[model samples]
Target: MLELNFIRANKSRVIQGLKIKNFSEEDLQIVEEILSLDDTRKEVQTELDSLLAERNQLSKTIGDLMKAGKRAEAESQRERVGQLKEQAAKLEDSLKDTKVQLEELLLKVPNIPHESVPPGATPEDNEVYKAWASPLPELSSDALPHWELAQKYNIFDLELGVKLTGSGFPVYRGKGAKLERALISFFLDEATRAGFEEVIPPLMVNEDTARATGQLPDKEGQMYYVERDNLYLIPTAEVPVTNIYRDVILDAADFPVKMTAYTPCFRREAGSYGAHVRGLNRVHQFDKVEIVVLQHPDKSYETLQEMLAHVSGLLDKLELPYRILRLCGGDMSFTSALTFDFEVFSAAQKRWLEVSSVSNFETYQSNRMKLRFRDGKATRLAHTLNGSALALARVVAALLENNQTPEGIVIPKVLRDYTGFELLN
Candidate 1:
């Protein structure tokens, strides 16, 4: 959440930022309403405090008057105190209502877009940050899509997946399964080598963890629920991995903490369809390696670029054609101030598929999680960031689709050692 004080002080700037993000003018008005409500709340609390102070002084005066045997004066002071108490109670109620108003409005507001963000409404408006390695490979019109190639190689069984679970879940067999495992291992190793501590986070997280990652209140419908236990099957490793720092207060020495985790994530995909859901593009359950970082507020944006570079390096190693896109405000997540999506070209499909998203949430998650650090001077909120080093399913899908030669599927040179094979027939 954006700081209430910052929202109050920078209302105009925030509104303009939202406009760049394509938020309606009505949302701008709602922000103004929150500031107005905050002012009213402060006024009511001030009045109640003043009334309480007056009552206390009068109570002492009544005691003194009673001791002096001035019964009439004591009686009058008692009546004044009673009236003050009644007024204070009413003020307290008004203050409570104003606070509720402020909270409701604040929840509806979106984060201010960074000045660097392009003014646009959708992904089509996003500017490509950069491309990795070289130009994309050419695909013939008859190139088999990943799903078709999966069937030809006997690697993925969508029919079996649907029988066991649902449509979005696909079962992997033989080399495909091993390849998935290898991808997970390779991603974890590469991230660990880059100073990230690897962790195996729980697949199911409690309500608190979901809220810490900004998935509960607004995105509850998009995740699977263990109804009996009231736990949410994690939608991403970001939920469990990042929440580890929830409610923590670190020293300045712990300025930039980096961690990575590999986990199977579950998503509901309640209402999704068409070509976008083909193959590994959208799945109910998928494996992914994620990197989360907590950095000093001053160093957050820089850390975000560092993460981008790390992901770009992996793409380069794999020799995949990919592009980095700056997500526009309308396309940005509720918790992220900024986001960069990584897309890999699928030659067989002749399209680009999203493989990862690296986001700098700034203090949005930290504020909700109460993750702070003591800087000796003040307790400041830490900047939080997370990115998929690579989501295994989509990466494999892209690899399979792109590496399809008439002979076999040639594995990327970097992953060959991990997979223990040069090609899959």
Candidate 2:
């Protein structure tokens, strides 16, 4: 949510940002509507304040009149006070209603894009922030895609997953299961070494938690809801992990609060179909290691770079060929002020698959979460950032497809210790 004062002061800029974000002309009118509602709120508040002050003065006069033995005069003042009370009550209700309307409109407005964000409307318009300069690994004609490789090695079974759950769910078997565990351990260890505190948050969160992280009204359709309990299955560890600081206020000294978690994310990819969604390309449930940061506003962009470097280092260790893309305004998430996505080359599949997305929300989330830090005499919203150190499904797909050999699928050296005997055969 945007600070109301900011919107009031920078209405034109807010509208411009929304336009760049692909908001239609109809949606753009919301800004004007919000301002109008705010006007009503202020008018109601001023009237209520004046009315209360007048009533207080009249009640004091009534007491003085009664003490003076002027019973009739005091009774007249009492009647006037009763009328003022009724008027004040009505004004108070009007003020409350206006505030509710203001808040509802504010919630509909998305975070403004940073000035540096490119103006575009789709993924194709995103800039290639970093290109993969090295030669992409080439696979032989006989080389198999990850799904075929999985079958050859008895790695994971989509059919078994269908029997147990549904399509889009894959059950790992043998070395595939081991690989998943090894990747989780490897990512967690890497994060801890980089000074991030590891946390194991609950997989389900209440509606307040969901809304605090900007996942409720925006991406609610993608989440799995436990209707009876009113809980949502987390779509990403970012949702729960970042909410840890919800409603928290910290000292300025806590400039960078870093935390990480590994979780199984659940997303309902409704209406998704075709060859692009094959095997692990898209799934309802997937394991991922997420890194979240709450930073002082001035240092947030700097922290974002550090996070990008950390994720890049992981990919380097895994020896995956990858490139980073700076997402255009429309391609970015509703909560992200700026985002960079990492795509790894899948040799057998002959494509680039997104494996991670690092973003700096720049108070977009902190505002909604009420996460703040004290700066001198004033409190300010902190900037929140999060990234997939690596989402395992696509990483595994890239690993299996890119590492295929006449012998077997070779595990990256960084994960060998975790997997014990790594070469999946």
Candidate 3:
């Protein structure tokens, strides 16, 4: 959610940014509509203030008239006061309605992309910020994709998952289950070593929690909702972990508040059907280790670079051939001001799998969450940032496909200690 004052001041810039994000001309008109509604709100507020002041003065006068033995004048003043009260009540209702309308419209407006964001409308338009310079892994002609490999090795069973719950939910067995646990542990250890405090948050959140993180009304359809409880299954650990600071105020000393968590994310990948969605390429439930930061506005972008480095380090340790892409405006998330996606090459599948996305939301989420830090005498919204240290499904898929030999799949050396004997045969 954008600060109304910012939008009022930068109307043209906001419109241009929205246009880059592929907003239609019809949607661009929302900016003008918002301004008009704001004008009405100000007028209504001014009238309400004046009316209350007048009523207060008249009430005092009525007391004075009664004390001076002027009963008729006091009675007349009382009648006028009653009429003013009725008008005030009507104005209050109107003011409340206008505010509701204003908020609804504001929610519809997405965060404006940063000035550096490229103007484009699709994934193909995204710039390859960092290309893989090293040679990609090569597999033999008979190399099997992760799905076939899983069946041969008894790693995970998608068919059994359908019988248990539904598609996109795979049941890991034996070594596959152990490998998943190892990856989670490895990511968590890496995050903590880099000064991030680890947290275990609930997988489900209430409406306020969802809205505070910009998930409501925008990506609502992608979330799994529990109507009976009015709660939502979180799509990422970022939701619950970031909400920890919602409605909070902090000190300047806490410039970069960092935290991390591992969560089983739930997403409704509706209408997704293709050869690309095979195996662990896409799933309804998947494990991810997320890192979140709350930083001073001036240092937020700096913090973003640090986050990117951290994710890159993780991929490097895993020995995966990967590249980074600076997402184009239209390919970015609703709340992200800027984003960089990391893709690892799956040798057998012969495709790039997106395994992580690091983003700096600036004050987009902080404004909605009312998360702030005290700066001298005033409070300012904190910048919010989060990224998948690594989403395990694709990473696992890439690992199995790239490391497969006639004997077994070789686990990365860094995970050997965690996985014990990690030759998943």
Candidate 3 structure lDDT: 0.95
Per-candidate local distance difference test: 0.87, 0.93, 0.95
Q: Tens digits of per-residue lDDT for model 3 on 1-425? A: 99999999999999999998999999999999999999999999999999999999999999999999999999999999999999999999999999999999999888899888898989999999999998888899999999999999999999999999999999999999999999999999999999999999999999999999999989999999999999999999999999999999999998789999999999998998899999999999999999999999999899999999999999999999999999999999998999999999999989999999999998899999999999999999999999999999999999999999999999999999988976989
TM-score result, candidate 3 = 0.96
Candidate ranking under TM-score, highest first, comes to 3, 2, 1
User: Best-fitting candidate, measured by lDDT?
Assistant: 3
RMSD of each: 3.2, 2.1, 1.8
Decide which is better by lDDT, 1 or 2: 2
lDDT (C-alpha) at residue 150 in model 1: 91
Instruction: State TM-scores per candidate.
Output: 0.90, 0.95, 0.96
Q: Candidate 2's error at 347, in angstroms?
A: 1.1
- lDDT score, candidate 3, position 43: 99
